[model samples]
Target chain A: MIELKDVYFSYPSGAVLEGIDLTVKKGEYVGIMGHNGSGKTTLARLITGLLLPGKGYVRVNKIFTTDSERLLDIRRSTGMVFQDPDAQAIGETVEEDMVFGLENLGLPVPEIDTRIEKYLDLLGIRELRHRNIRTLSGGQKQLVNLAAVMVMEPECIILDEPVSMVDARCRKMILQHIARLNHEGTAIVHITHDPEELIRCHRLIVLSRCRVTNQGTPHEVFGQLLDEKKMDVPAPYAISRKLGLSPVLTIKALLEELCRSRSGN
Target chain B: MSIEIRQLTHIYDASTPWETIALDRIDLTISKGTVFGLVGGIGSGKSTLASLMAGLGTPAHGSITIDGEPPDPGRNVGILFQQPEDFFFEKTLFEDMASGLLHLGLTEEEVHKRIHSTLDLLGLDHQILDRSPFHLNRGTLRLAAFATVLTMRPGYLILDEPTASLDPKSRKRLVEVIKRISGDIAIIYISHRLQEVVAVSEYLAVLEQGKVAFTGTVPGYLDWATGQDAWEYLPVLNQVMYGLQRLGFDVDLNVACLEDAVEQIRLSLERT
Candidate 1:
């Protein structure tokens, strides 16, 4: 659903991304990870058409992102969640924020209301509908941001460190919702620094020093890409490896392996 | 300096429609040279408590004392806000660091000397003094902000989600620096990342709905939180160990880091 073709992007200071070629098929969950200044956010902006590539192109839903005529279509197909929750919000109330994008699209009032209610319930934030956005905590505001984007029913969602501000409880809730949405065939591109969040992603892409250095499944990437690149491995994965066992990303998987081995499986 | 808070209650926009009882009759204390971790979900009064302790705002009820005197936010506490930019407004790092020092009646030479020494303490290069605070990367900005705070040398330091939005390398570096200096200053670390909290903090407090839900050492809180419904608040290592405990594997939930967890798991398996 999303593709980047030999893309090169730069700012006034320096080139950020170079020789990028990638694609995300329908319903694919792609985890993009790299350290700060690794051009990860720039890639997200490029795919969402927020920033045009300096050279080459980015396409969403087979439509060139640079095409002004199809700008609305591009935006409708891909929703981008930014890193900072406070900066991205424009609405005074939670419900208002959820409907902001739809109202901008000039959808019917009843349809917008229906969508707002549906998504808020889906995210378990229905009770926070009328509350002032400023009063909500960082995690709640982020959940509202997610509801705002998902209410529009985009084909693909690009989340840029959505859970970084949230507490562990709310982060899990948000990730579970993202996983469910992806399972329902909406493509997901999650940009983050945490390895725990990366396990659910079907494919992993690592960018470094303005280039794509690694791309593979979670296991493949964790097996060597993380260590070889000096990337941060999740604590569970690192601990399992330290104990001379095959490292598993998730806690549930690790527990299963431990039980199996202890029971002489 | 030690801090003692008793019957603390804070209400934002009180007696109005926007009224929020951010904190309710909370009592706490932070001794010198120890890391006190304040953890809670969003809107659970964590920031309110931090602000109150930092003297950013006045508590509507109760009392706060620093070494048997009323706490002074300006003189006794240094708070690194959730956003680095919140604590900075100058055009350059040098000016920002100087702004805080100028108020202390220090001469230019003295201010520069203090800033340089503070930067050295935080392991920041003096070259960054020429750059704009807005232009630096997140990690550098964080360290720059740290230098600004350390220039004051407040007895109490309040850090709100210090590692959020930071890369692993930056996070590790910041944690190491905090560890290096933790013996001298009392640190009140507020974060949802329980692993980092466990690693840095010697004491713990879990806030729930504007109340102190649990308080104790890392291991004590882990045992208490594991049986509670707030499973997400548990650190990744503890969560995995809790799962192992559920599966009938006698595992210790107190392992703080990956290395500790590895040792614990090895010993558990060998015993099995």
Candidate 2:
């Protein structure tokens, strides 16, 4: 669980995020979106205890974000995967890397090995266990990063553009995984600019100029974006138009709708 | 002032296990002052082709000539690579744009004039001149990236995934700028979306498995590309209409924009 009350954060170049209020309950998956420099990442840091709020209070699992004594416990409850895969993955080998976080958590040795395999299989990275970190591509590196944190079995994960640099296939896989994790009762806060991924999120939030511009399910937030016509709808816009369907987001859904309608017996 | 390529081949990580033959005996010509669009899924070498044109990378074999000279990364070509954050490092917009021109041997006053004009052309206010490059949002970063490259004034202006992360308003503004700027330089605009390419480009190329699969007019390429499922990023209305028609329903493939589709549906309803 997370809670923020009347928070304010600023950098030297004026104020990045000011007078913010937010809350993320346990087992809730939220996606945060913005164009850029929208204070989305700043908010992420505030939640993860990376930055102390200049004003107001942030609570993770009922513990204050600024409480030094509760910092380790609060941090243990959440794990993060950044946009750049290279920045994480400190270990040389995948298996060793996965175990590094476990070691820091100070779990027992045999249990650590079990967790390594368990999460590696959970994230589908078992085959890459023995590979060197540098040999993996951008997507593979990200998967390993996921596996590493997952072994610790944190209650929630905060992913900042986890699939930004990845190929389309991997992007789909990661999005599906995020959905699955959310279904399994793990909270997720995904920050990204890609709409294809945004459509997959359960609840979406938009940050503009460091304030919560909008918050709702993907349908609500992006529906407003479409209404503004500031952004173009996905491909097959014409197909939806012909069918007179209310602008479905993905192609598969549109196809299904068309199939059902054309069979109008 | 025409562009020509003959048997262009590019290899990445040559001789290593990851040696990828990016471009393979590709030959093509793009007339100057035209929008040439490029498309492909990831690792298809579309970016590689742009890099070659922008002079960021050398062709392993064959030749590329722009205005009768080879494409040189260090000179003559202005390239905005895929990741906007990669090429940016300076503190201020002025410094970022001036970094490239300092080597071109321009006078200080000349650099200032060029920088201000380019910023104005991009519709960025002069106040943004003093802001940190990193402080700007993704859309601003993208425009700043373009401004930085355009300040160099190369014969060829290239942008890889130029508008990928941009919002709608900025995207429209940037597209307008590109259209206005195209008359003076060859624009090698690389994007995955066939629709955007169709809207802005006179010429088009689709990269598949490291080669040019389709190269012709934008409409011609889209006609072929729309059939490939468009990697699922293709517009919603187009696919819906096409899928319905595939199942023996009536649908028009000519509807490029969403409003036209909406109007078509409402009109069809009245007729029915």
Candidate 3:
């Protein structure tokens, strides 16, 4: 679980986030969206304890991010996948990189091996187990990064634009895996710019100009955002609205709706 | 007026234990004033092909010619790699743009003119030149990196996932910039985002395991995709149209933009 109250963060250059209040309960999937330089990444780092807030506080699992003594506990409870995959590499090979975090956690060797195998297989990267990290493509590196984080089996996973570099197949696979993990009671805080990716989120938070401007269910937030022309939305949702029908998330649902309407059902 | 690639193959760490064939016997042609999309799964050799086209490295086999001559990397072909901002090491964006032009033996006046004109062409303001590239936001940094390349006036451009981490507004802006300048230069737009590829490209090549699985005009590829049942490769609007067609609805599958798709769907429903 994560909570932030009246959180205000600033960089040496200037202020980034202001008067933020948010919480993610256990197993809750929250999506954070904003334009570039809108303090989205800054907020993610604050929650992960990578950076301390300048004015207020960020708490994960009831442990304050400012609590340096319990930073390890905070890290164990939460894992973060950064936007850039190249910056997160710590091992030469895929398997080794995955094992690095588990080894640091001091898990038994058998446990570490089991977790590495489980996640690599889950992420569909088993064939890349021994491939050099440098040789992998940007999307492959991103999968490796997710596998490495998931191996830790943290209570919550914070993904920053996890699918941006991946192909459509891999993107769907990663989102499905993340959703499965959330269903299994792991918290998810997905940060992305793509509105389509947030369709499945339980709650959505919109940030802009250093403040929280919107927060609600995906339908509620997307409805208001679309009306305001403030953000780009998924094609299905946009078309449904244009056709005087309730907005839907996926293309399959939109087709069903269209069929039912044509039949007057 | 065009780039010709034939039997191009590139192998990493050749003849060694770590040898991996990055590309294999790929052939393509990119005419000036066209946006050619190169899409594939991760490690499917999209970047490898881009590098080969940019003359970053020699291919293990086959040939590449830009306007019937070997590609001259900065002068004839400019590549904006993923995370291109990382390549900026100058004190300011202006100096960064100037340095590349300076290396080409251009006079200071010419360098300044080129930078300003490129920025104007990209719809970026001159005020950004005074700021450090490091301090600029991701969107601005990307455009600045692009300006650095466009200032050289390359006949061909290679953009690798230019909109990967960009927000929607910035992504739209960059796509517009690509469309605006695509008239004067051939662009190889490499990305995992199929929607963007569909939006900007006239022709597309889909790679699978270092081989070209499909290549044709945008509409031709869309028609091909509908038959493949690989809905992942198609944009959401196309996917909806494909799904409707499966349910026996008469809709236009070749439509790309949402407005056209919506209109097609409306007409289809009214017909029934």
Question: Local error of candidate 1 at A220, Å?
Answer: 1.0
In model 1, what lDDT does residue A244 have?
A: 69
TM-score of chain B of each: 0.94, 0.90, 0.96
True contacts kept of 1: 0.68
* Candidate 2 residue lDDT tens string, B145-171: 888888888878777777764656677
Please say which candidate is ahead in TM-score: 2 or 3: 3
Collision pairs in model 3: none
Question: How big an interface RMSD has model 1?
Answer: 2.1
Per-residue lDDT of model 1, residues B1-272, tens digit only: 58999999988667766677889999888899999999988888997788878876788999988888776765788888776755667888899889877887789998888899988887888888998776677778888887788888888899988888888998998998889898998999998888899889999898988999998988788878887745687888888888888888777877766777778788889988
Model 3 Cα shift for residue B8 (angstroms): 1.5
Name the docking class for model 1.
medium
Give the RMSD in angstroms, all C-alphas superposed, for model 2: 4.2
- Estimate, for each residue in A24-109, the C-alpha lDDT of model 3 and write its tens digit: 99999999999999999988899999999877788998899999999999999999998989879899988889888988999999
Candidate 2 Cα lDDT to native:
0.74
Report, to 2 decimal places, the DockQ of model 3: 0.72
Q: Per-residue lDDT tens digits of candidate 3, residues B86-138?
A: 88888888988898889999999999999999898888989989988877888
Can you tell me the CAPRI class of model 2? acceptable
Ranking by DockQ: 3, 1, 2
Superior by DockQ: candidate 1 or candidate 2: 1
